[model samples]
Target: MENTTTLGCLVLLCIFITFPRTKGACRFRRFGIDCRYSCNCPGGCNDVNGVCRGPCYPGWHSGNGTVCQTKNIAYNGSTKQSSNYYTFKYLSNKAVDGNRDQNIYDGSCSHTGLNKTSASWQVNIEPPTQIYQVKMYYRQDLRKRFRRFTLYLNDVDEEWRVCYHHQKDSIQSIVNVNCNITTKTKALFVYNERGTPETSGQSYERHAYMELCEVEVYVCSKGTYGDCRQFCYCKDGPCDFITGQCPGSGLCENGFTGQHCQTDCSSIGKYGVNCSESCSASHCFNRQMCHRVTGRCLDGCQDGWIEPTCVKHTQVVPCHLSVKVNSDATELCIRSL
Candidate 1:
């Protein structure tokens, strides 16, 4: 009886170890999944019920589920420079009155009336380094005269030491100014200074109406300190100075077409490099692929022949022999020879 009781107790212990009671089983209330052990949450820890938790890092924002995206800030008002930058215009005169020319340089001596006033705009910028460049487009009217204008960096107090002044009749000048800022600056100010009073009794008022057509500020990377050539390379794309790839779509200017866009059709097949020579029927009798670089055919064909390839030929063919007509006053005689 004692041996049977011990055997029964052993059997009960084995059953309990193999198949435990289902009560108190840890159930993942959020995912609707049950586990024998404590639920080790996957991915991010569940902060609240039915939702995962994560944070967007710097320069990026959390967009919906588990996705981070870079924030796109407007550079220019309406003009789009690229996916990264924008180009916008800041006019001196917003009233649309003809008193102010849109292209005139602001804060210049020659700008008359209310057009002489100067304005500044702010932009959010990101640079790879502390040194950057600012580009401005300016033009003066033929009658206007200007001495110098001051460009302020970041604030009206911190101004560029160099004064940009142009003589009369200097129209449409593009100026690139380099700036180094120790502190973060988001605003730029432009000041106009008139040199002397005009003969009309009105002060020149610096007739310098300035227009900010486009401004590009890029941070310089290492090994490119004070080197304009290095500045040319630190563009949006990889530098290809030999091909001038930084400005355009990796293509050369003019009517050229190629990878580097260096080949000009007008400059090919000419006396030297210009396309001047005209191919004649004797040189290129049949339809042939004329050498673009040279006005000559690779192969020549017979007079009545079409092409060396002969993929297709003209249906009309001229006979080799012709009929001879005999000279007669009344009767006419003709024979094929």
Candidate 2:
């Protein structure tokens, strides 16, 4: 009877281990067996395995895509601001050092000069990786210092797209924004437009300042969309990060045709934009063969045909008759070809 009871207990334990009781679902940023582990991952974490829902936060890496470890992508990047406040102690690189200390005196935040019409901060991510999201931690004591600020993505010197904008006067100490850009860029800007409006006409209210505590820029190590598991195969630039489709209003690259710009124009003896210009139709000399880029005839034009493009007929001189007046005698001379 004791042996029988032991066998029944083993069966009961197996069932209990196989089916643990469900206690609702774990909230965002929390994961574990009992939902106890917590980390400030921007894309959240999986409830079952504690892996990051997206890529690990900037300045962080996941060896197994589950544990967030020390690897500073943002800290390695360079930073600069419009102006430094007071002294050089409050440098722009402090914001990206992976420190969240709100105290500027603690050497973890960035500050700009006072009474400025506009203020800006920019970070240069070397090698130009895909920017999934940006999170800014502002100084809580002086939240008013940051108003009407905007986030922009830059390629070299040009601002290609706007990541986010703050329209309200009142904001929290921390702000998170998703960029969702198709192509990768090298720079990012946190800018305040020129001439801030004054609420009470105070001198401080007429200007803007950049007082950032910490800045986090998230990027996937590999894929772009949907938990960073899928990849894009576009010929030029990149496809939409989320949709995995070609960007730029359905426009394809030169010498390529189709929605994804995958088909080669040379396969059909065609060239130019969208492969609309055909080499055969252009009268190429080498059996309608042409260069894919310039659409020029490879072996020159056929007999009596133009050299380039081979589309026009060669001009031919017609027979002519010339009439001349002699100065010595009052006689007319006619010369025939």
Candidate 3:
């Protein structure tokens, strides 16, 4: 019994020692009535990339370089992918490292050198970013590579949707290819492969390769960029970078979202940024304290409202050929004379 007790104590001690050093997620009131996640940690917090999250201290605070720095998702790896072959697979992902400069002496790590023209490079960005453009700095030493290329962005369906394609006529030097896309994507792809129009028109075109010295991907600002259904902002108020919400109702102190919460939460069934959430009220009609979504019904249909759409159901022309439509169908009404 003593031996068992000792072993149990040791196990407990090991667990305590090995646990990740993170405080439990906490929430507390802001200005006495508002609640918010505690960003004012003693040390620091991990961000979306699982690294130390940073920015400020508390109440218009100060910091090193962590503040004013948002996300640079191009270099971060968070996608699930497998490639048959990527040019210069020896040391991949050197292009998106935010370093576009080249070294003449040591040209090895400066770029990718794929032998097969069919090679490709891909990366996933997680949390679907709103991309606008991609800038590529091809290898200057080679000077002739990546003239013809294609860039793709992933859709909500996770497909490698082609957004832009480039075809160059001459062998330009020190030229940066800028492709404008402006779409939401979780995956990004770059290639100089088959099916993308061979420039030389030679059979050797099949053996073409690519050397990307650097690549810069730009995303649309969530507050004012693409997929922002509609946002609300008073005077020139900015929005939250992470949530795309503006701060505060033009009057309420809870803070706004989407274009500074300028996005209307007035939808009958949805609310929040881009109206992404369902209402919390069970029956909007019965008014049993609805969800954070202003108009959504948490419970079943209340009074005359229906599921999903929390608005009062008024009789209207049926859209489908169902029993309701048949009952209301008249020869003249069907013919629309």
What does the lDDT come to for candidate 2? 0.68
Ranking of all candidate structures by their TM-score, best first: 2, 3, 1
lDDT values for all models? 0.35, 0.68, 0.46
Q: Per-residue lDDT tens digits of candidate 1, residues 55-166? A: 4322222323432212222133222111111122233322112122334344321122333433233343333123245544444343233224455554334434332334
| Residue ranges of candidate 1 with Cα displaced over 4 Å | 1-74, 77-131, 140-147, 155-172, 180-184, 195-208, 221-337
Q: TM-scores of the models, in the given order? A: 0.28, 0.48, 0.41
In angstroms, how far off is 185's CA in candidate 2? 1.3
TM-score of 3: 0.41
Runs off by more than 4 Å, candidate 3: 1-71, 78-90, 104-115, 171-183, 194-199, 202-206, 220-337
Candidate 2, residues 264-300, lDDT tens digits: the string is 5655788888788888876676755776556777666
**Which has the greatest TM-score?**
2
Global Cα lDDT for candidate 1: 0.35
Of models 1 and 2, which has the larger TM-score?
2
What's the distance in Å from true for residue 232, model 3? Answer: 9.2
Q: Report the candidate with higher lDDT, 1 versus 3.
A: 3
